[model samples]
Target: MKRSTTLISVTLIFASIFSAGSRGGDALGKDSAGSENPMRRFLIEDGDPNLSAIIKHIDNMYRSKSSTSRLKLIVTKPRNTRTLTMKTWTKGEEKVLVIIEAPPREKGTATLKIEKNLWNYLPRIDRTIRIPPSMMLASWMGSDFTNDDLVHEASFHKDYESSLVGPSEDPNGWLIELKAKPDIVGLWKKLEVIVSEDGRIPLVSRYYDRKGRLARTLYYSDVKDFDGHIIPSKLVLIPEDKKGHKTELIYEDIDFDVPVPDRTFSLSNLERKK
Candidate 1:
């Protein structure tokens, strides 16, 4: 009788241990599921109170001093034509001004301010016309890039919700894909931004049109150290529909945090600056 009692007690203890182990395993599996979901992680991480580093990095990139560049714009469809020389200056995210020096017939300077303000200082007409937001999607100086691309320099963190799409590899380095929130205001309906895991520089971005088609592919190449941060010296914009045509922007000179006068960003400056 004593032996049977002892055996029964041992069996009950073993069963309890087995039950506890099973419950613990189930809990761990649930935790794993939450971590693996990219959307869930993005929402939680984006809401982190400490986002100063990301914000500062974006601000420094957009608010820098003038950057001179030579842009070669190719239009493939009607004919394989190209525009040779161009120079650009950016005064923060609010203003971007470009001057085209070559192809005398089409040569002129255009200044684009944020939102609804824009002007083209046509040496030919010697007049300025205010551009509206509806025309933002129009080709920029006959290039593949739209006017909206120039003025919409808002930081991704501020304008869109970001999520890690899991570990992936790209030409640049280890990458994590980030999808923009549906309600975010921007030209692209969705964006797949490839960011280097080590450097945190955005490498390649695939932009989808409003209908969810892959409309454009933007590759950030020739990364150079500007000041203390790494910036892409060249950005190549290629439209999927326009085969054989690409816009390559080569940054010749760049400076950051320089004092830009208030007048530089004004609409009057756009019209007056020859």
Candidate 2:
């Protein structure tokens, strides 16, 4: 397949969806009211006090004031395998910029997401194309993930109602169930997440389609301590219906709560060479 075709088909996933906000520690973070961020009024809290805390913890895990990282994406198939290296910059939940670094042909290609808008820069043609809302669910870069996954348009706390599913022995963690709220539009109707018992790190998440069928599974591993924060450095995503197909995202380096200039997320910077 042509490099352009592959790049166009590839969709963003791990970085925006799972990367930013958690502060690793013993106590759960607080909400705006200066209280614990968990759903205290929910019945699930009565059954497992940690359930709500875990949900809130994981929801904010990858979030930070600002962050920067270099990642390696490996997409594997039955007949072919390809790799790409990229550097990413993010500011809070609003701005994100991803620039390809390796594979000479795609070296300068970039994607920018600011608030609700997303755009891609193709260096080869010196053109910028805006991604419409209609393509939010489209697969990115020929991968299993979607465009929405790239920009993180959905929030677990706001979009899904969660419940405690007890313990999981296989991964040795707590199982949490999340069902989509009827009002929100998303590809996954439900999700099952296994969170590590110790630090509440997400170990595995199973995505279920609208029909309640298992669609894909995301496995998080290789825990690393970045500064004071503990996070999974590697993530592997596999679709249930596809054989010998999977995408592995490995974090090469990351810095959280770092300084990021405003222009870094601008349209002009999208065309700037790395």
Candidate 3:
């Protein structure tokens, strides 16, 4: 396929729906009376009492303040499959630039994300197009992961109300369930995440729809040291009903707390090589 055709076809898959948000992370605050929170009534605080700690670790696992990574993303759908090799530089959740580096056809194609605004650069046309709100939920780069995941529109800590699923559902690992706040928007109605108690490594996350039906599951595996921090190097997302469809993101290399130039997030740099 021609380079332009490939880009067009891949982008079209994500046109169904989306929005992008920038920052995340929220700490527990005092209730209205500055005392006990009413939500805590339904949560576990007896045995583990580590609900807050788990939430904090999960929220901060992937990135520090700034990071750079070489990622290999693979997507498979029915009769088609595609692999993309991209280099991503991120300054927190708000500022990010992902540039396709391999498969020559998409060499200069890049996406710049700053806050809620997103822009896509098409090197073939030498143009930068601002992504509209309607496209925020679209599959990003033709992967099952949406643009929302890319930009972090909803914070896992703030947007969702979390509670420990209790010891009955928890054995060797911690099981935390999160329900989206009324104001937040996304396809998932609730999410159940399992992480190791000691290593804080994510094991599995099940996404449920509004009706409480399983939508998809994200599996994390292959723990390795990315410099000083240990984290899962591979994440695979599998749909509940889609038999042959799944997306995998593998971190070839990652450097947390890496120095990112102040100007690296600018629009003009979208088409510029690092």
Best by TM-score: 2
Error of 2 at 209 (Å): 0.8
What's the lDDT for all of these models? 0.48, 0.70, 0.63
Best by lDDT: 2
- Per-candidate RMSD, Å: 22.9, 5.0, 7.5
Question: Which 10 residues in a row give candidate 1 its minimum summed lDDT?
Answer: 10-19
Question: Model 1 Cα RMSD, Å?
Answer: 22.9
Q: Which lDDT tens digits does candidate 1 get at residues 114-177?
A: 3335555666677765554455544344345654544454445555655555445666443333
Off by over 4 Å in 1: 1-62, 65-78, 104-108, 112-115, 137-143, 265-273
| Better candidate by TM-score, 1 or 2 | 2
lDDT string, candidate 2, 1-274, tens digits: 2343333333234335434344322244323122233433331344453665567666666566777888898989899998999888877666777788988988889877777677788899999888766566565445666555554546677789998787889898778899999988877899998877542578999999889999899999998866555678898989888889898889888887789998998888887753
- Clash count in backbone of candidate 2: 15
Q: For every model shown, what is its TM-score relative to the native structure? A: 0.66, 0.83, 0.77
lDDT of 3 at 41: 36
Angstrom error of the Cα, residue 192, model 3: value is: 0.7
